[model samples]
Target chain A: MTTAEVSAPTTEKPKRDKPMGTETRVAWTFIAPGAALLLLFIVAPFVLAIWFSLTNQRLISPLPTRFVGFENYLGELADPLFWKSLWNNFRFAAFVVPAQTAFALLLAVFVNQRIAGRVIFRTIYFTPITVVMAAAATIWVLLFNVNGLVNGFFELITFGNFAPDWLNDPTWAMWAIIVVSIWQGVGFQMVILLAALQDVPGELYEAASIDGAGAWKQFTNITVPGIRNALIFVFTVTTILAMRLFDQPTLMPRSPGGPLDSTRTTMVHMVDLGFGRQAIGRGSAIAVIFFVIVLILTLIQRRFLKEESAQ
Target chain B: MTADSDVRVSAKKSVGANPLWRWVLYSVMIVLAAFFLFPLVYMVASSLIPDDQVLAKSQSFEAFVPTPFVGLENFSDAIERANLPRVFANSVIISGLIVSLGLVVNSLFGYALARLRFPGRKLLVGVVVALIIIPFEALAVPLLFMGAQVGWLDTYQIQILPFIASPLFIFLFYTFFLSIPRSLEEAAMIDGASPVEIFTRVVAPLAKPAYATVAILGFLFSWGQFLWPSIVTRGVDVRPLPVGIGVFATTPPVSWGDIMAYTVLMTLPLLVIFLIFQRQFVQGVASSGVKG
Candidate 1:
């Protein structure tokens, strides 16, 4: 698929300007269905979200809706639980972005080697990515049980000194979710980085070694720079994913964002308010805020990374 | 050393030529592999055991081994209790529609963007690129409100329609269509073939990899959909497997074995497909990741 296709000769050259009318009509006809759907689904919802945030809209309400400019936003800003959920989102991203990226890069480098059974190893590591997050969370909820295999292994290794109730414990709930997120997501980054690693010319490594460079030196100088763009890409994508932490926390915990609201991410909070509490206005407010944060982070990362790459 | 010797040294280093280092590398890979495989292996094993014995055996190495196997008892129980058949059919219909229709719609738009000289072509492409940055979660709340307002709640189309015109997939298709040579289309055009004929007979045949990549990824995305379906479908009539499994796992009188069985059942088809199309799966992910 990557190889360039050979161009074939034509029997006759069609006048491009003459077919402009027909070509434009055909193009619009082709694009119409998808463009209309995008307009109805994505664009319309986005606009409604902003409008809903401004007004006091309820999912099912008796009173007529009225404009309540900035009230929902102000309420959310004043709510400690809202701040907690936002903090939890940031905290999850902080741990996952670095940990998953590093681990994935490590796995990618290892599997990139010319080792026997590397394909099998790659497949094994990547199996989690295929499993649905709900299934992964369900399986992991059992594993993270007090007397489950995870604690059992930890007890065996630590001589029974430590075994926390992962999901129920407020302190450990987010951490458990983080572990699952990293486990399920690292394989994706690994595959991407592995592809990037393969693209790094072997000649550079050979040249570096000729200058008496060690493996670590060659890795730091040649390998890292070679895959710099991929590293940034992985970092940014992982952060965005971490910010959307919902399925695991919702499914794993006793309740969605249980244990003192410790695992209440922004998305979870939005859902709880919007659907569960039937506070559509507040939920839309949170959604707008969440969207802005994601947009700003993505834009900042793009600019920052582009500058770094330039340097 | 000579240039040839340097190449040999690097080649040897790439594979860990030293015996002890290679042994260490193998050991690490094996341990990591085991770590990655343990939860899945345990899930399968627990699914086969009886409910009472599932958690009991999880405390030790025996958890990895399915003893006192009850065969398909848990599977039968889970299917009956969770209404797995209905949910499974629902998931199949939903994902199938999304994948098939999505391919046609998104690929057509992509092809138009790549090949057609429409008036608003550049503007449409820019809009798609801009739309790619909007996370779906950010829109879920408002979409739910919109869905409720339009009386679209508790329907299969609500789950399937919004996702059919994905910006990311559209962009992926756009870039892929751009990459292929257009000479064949031109040749076909010279033969008095219309644009649609040229697209179907000449261009579509050559874009199999792009289609396969989009189809596999699209199916996986739709099949695993949780958030949208959760809010939209309040009943089991149209709920997909991911949401079904989530609800099943959380329902009262939770049985570990039954839940594992259900999970295994929910995951089995995708696992089989992934194993069969491992190359395409990896390629799909890598290409999407690198291109994005």
Candidate 2:
């Protein structure tokens, strides 16, 4: 065939390619309902929240609302409770992210093996994650009760009458919530890591074994680098989850912030201010601030992980 | 066959000498598994004990043994006392509606992103990625206000409406749809099938795995939802299981056995579904790959 024959076929295909067609319209039709729902439920509310945050709003009021320029933001910034909860949130994140990520990775490495009963072990490890929120919280509440299982265990280990109210004592409540959070969240991190671990090529391990590398050497040089992307993913997710801490404290605490606001995470504080105290503007400001903090932390995390990967 | 023969020879020669290493491996795994399993065993053990004995150190571990096993009395009392049945029904309705709506909505939005030629498509994607980071806590107050304005507070509408469309689900579906080879759809179109018919018959069926992933995740999030429902549903009239269980914590004369029974009840449906989709669920999550 001549060069012209081949070039003619390509030109003909371009000419005959059906005109921008009905598929596009059909796609929009199928997509509109969901798009519209998101606009109403999510996008619209977000805009309304910004507006509400700028005004002195009340849940039950017919009074004319007036805009106050940055007053709510300033007020929340100055408020001791707001700052305290913000600090507590940092502490919660500091403890949870490292603890859960390390523990999950350790568990995954041990269990991702060709061993007997591994399936059963995996299921047993992941079962607490499936426990519904309320049930899990209640069980923990019982476990942390002044004379609860934890105290009982502590007493038995100490060989004496040694019981401190795990949830009630101000010093211990936040730690109690952190412990349960790790228990509930580590399963998710483990599954992600395990899946990544399994994806590493078996040939790489065999190659390392041929070089007389022990398991520890092989893990550091091969497995860690192989699953580095997954490590970043799990770390980011756990950090996000830790920052969004709410339900654990709200459920476990005797009050909104048990024992002197020790367990009062920022999310819980925002809810308490907005709903419990009926300060919608203050609550919205807190939420907006909360969003900003999370955005900054996430950006910092991404940059740090990128640098780590580059190194 | 070569490696098998070699491994057999090596295994017979080395088995006796590796006893310490084998014990170490098994012991480490056993300890690690126990760490993960401890809380659950404690939860079950605590739940079976009498209310007084639940918090009392006087009772030994023997008290928690299932010997004089209490019948389903704990479950019935928990159901009545915590008003669990109503909450369970509410949870079912809310989660079911969200899952159904999410499947339809996400598939549609995903298809649009995959194939449509709409303006600002890139911009919309950007908005969604940003929104994923804006924690749900940030949206709670605004959603609550929006729901109240529409006369949806204290109703199932408030519980189900805010979550009907998940950005995470949309992102997953969009990626899945994009991966599908275009030839299949092109062939359908050439055969004179309309876009709607082609999509329903070709694209939709091929996207089953994606749909299943979206459904299970949507259901889990809605089922596990706590804060939004609590904020919107002020009364017991429309509260779901999580809220019901939260209220259970504050009630006087709380029953440990019944509370455990309630916990068991709450976890049953989700556990069944997770087990059923265990393989697919794992694949789906892993394939999403580095997403929130």
For each candidate, report what fraction of the true interface contacts it reproduces: 0.68, 0.51
**Winner by DockQ:** 1
Q: Which lDDT tens digits does candidate 2 get at residues A175-243?
A: 888888887778778878988887776667677777888778878998898888788888877887777
Candidate 1 lDDT, A1-311, residue by residue in tens: 11111111111114456687788899999999999999998999899999999999999999999999999999999999999999998999988899999999999989887778989999999989888989889889999999899899999999999899999999999998988888888999999999998877777877787798988898899989998888888998899888888898788899998888999999899999999999999999998998998898789778867787689
Candidate 2 error regions (>4 Å) = A1-21, A304-311, B1-19, B42-50, B57-59, B247-252
Question: Considering just chain B, what TM-score does every model have?
Answer: 0.94, 0.85
* Residue-wise C-alpha lDDT for candidate 1, range B1-292, written one tens digit per residue: 3765556446656558778889999999999999888889999999999998888889899998989989999999999988999999999999999999999999999999888775657677878989988899878988998888789999988988999998988999899999999888889989999989988888888889899989988987888888889888887999999888755545555688889999999899999999999999998888877775
Rate residue B284 of model 2 by lDDT: 59
What residue pairs are clashing in model 1? Answer: none
Model 2 lDDT at residue B42: 60
Docking outcome class, model 1: medium
Error of 2 at B281 (Å): 3.3
Error (Å) of candidate 1 at residue A25 is: 0.3
lDDT of 2 at B230: 83
